[model samples]
Target: MGASSPPRVTGRLRRTSLVDQAIAALQAEIDSGAWAVGEKIPTEPQLVERFGIGRNALREAIRALVHSGLLETRQGDGTYLRATSEFAGALRRRTSCSELLELVEVRRAIEVEAARLAAKRRSDRQAAELERLLAESAAAWRAGDVGRLVGADVALHTEIVRASGNAMLLELYESFGGAIAEAIRTELLDTATYSRPTHSALVAAIVAGDPQAAAAATAAALDEVRIGRERRSIGQPSR
Candidate 1:
């Protein structure tokens, strides 16, 4: 027997790995708008053939995306694209508080400079806007509207950064906006530490065009939030 023809080296090539193929195909479809938000995706078998993958591998890829919040599944219905996938989820998952504190430290550095610029460059209109946001914040606290208070707090800080008239500073501030907002909501607004007087001081400092005062006021407010978080931690019952 003629040495069994070197185990039949088939000319047909194997395609990419199943998981990568599935991810690539799905990503392309999403990028092309083939799978728009709220639109159900094709069944598993369909994806298997489309990406040339086995059932198990295809399911694994889909499950990964689902966990990432890029895809949502209903019990009876098919999977669909989520309207929005928060990048913050990834950040929170990948980084510990110590890692994030480094980022916050950087923010402290930039915020000081931003406050200085804001004091020098803030227009009358910007000052008025900051005042309005502060007023709303005070009103929200008095009315015990936690949600509204958080919104006003974010708006107030954002306005102050915007008033700095430095696009780069504003962009840096925006990068942390979501994290800051969540922090305020959970630590400040949820606790009784935040009060009308705290917001009033911040507003007054910004309106007075005093960079040192603005920085000092913000530091104080954040100190209160930190203290609140520490208190909650201390109050937690032993597991």
Candidate 2:
């Protein structure tokens, strides 16, 4: 928490052509879960119609997403979503594997402090958003949809970091989000998905302004994820 209030946008973003607008629109729909990873977007004609933009703008948008690794076009098969975010796409393109544990460690270091700051400074609106994201994560857990769970879980953590009001922290956490989601899917997909109370408890602590509790909760949640990854590495049972 700082003495100054949270930063505000002083002015609207500069207006752009239909191509930029289409790009933003497409990313918004994708981020909103309109299409899960690996799903094909509507056909080009359908997208062109949906966005009410010319073919050129839509194609430019598609190409940008493809370059960003958010979408992939297969010859004769149509363009399919490959990753949910640019960070995730970058992760997939890596020729060398980054250790998942290393990623989790960085996340733990960032999120623990973030949680404390969030508890101190989160607005009621931010708390409500955390509640909504928590419910989404819980629902994904209930459905046993690991993919959805990963998205919702990452979103929850990212929201907490955002609420901390630290732009740098938020950027670091976002960069790690893809690997964190991957770690969850790899390590906790089978076990501990519901083994402990996590998002709910963290939300409670933050909303209550209990910074200590918030920090404890975040560290515990990340530790649980790390332990799961360790258990798999050692060929131990999830329990």
Per-model TM against the reference: 0.59, 0.66
Candidate 2 local lDDT, 108-175, one digit each (tens): 89999999999999999999999998888888878877778777777888899999999999876765
Q: What's model 1's TM-score?
A: 0.59
- Return the TM-score for candidate 2, rounded to 2 decimals: 0.66
- Give the CA lDDT, 0 to 100, for residue 139 in model 2: 85
lDDT of 1 by residue, 151-192 (tens): 788788788789889998887676555556555555553456
> What residue pairs are clashing in model 1?
none
- In each prediction, how many residue pairs overlap at the backbone (N, C-alpha, C within less than 3 A)? 0, 0
lDDT to native, each model: 0.67, 0.80
Error of 2 at 206 (Å): 0.4
lDDT of 2 at 222: 79
lDDT of 2 at 82: 72
Cα deviation at 30, candidate 1, in Å, is 14
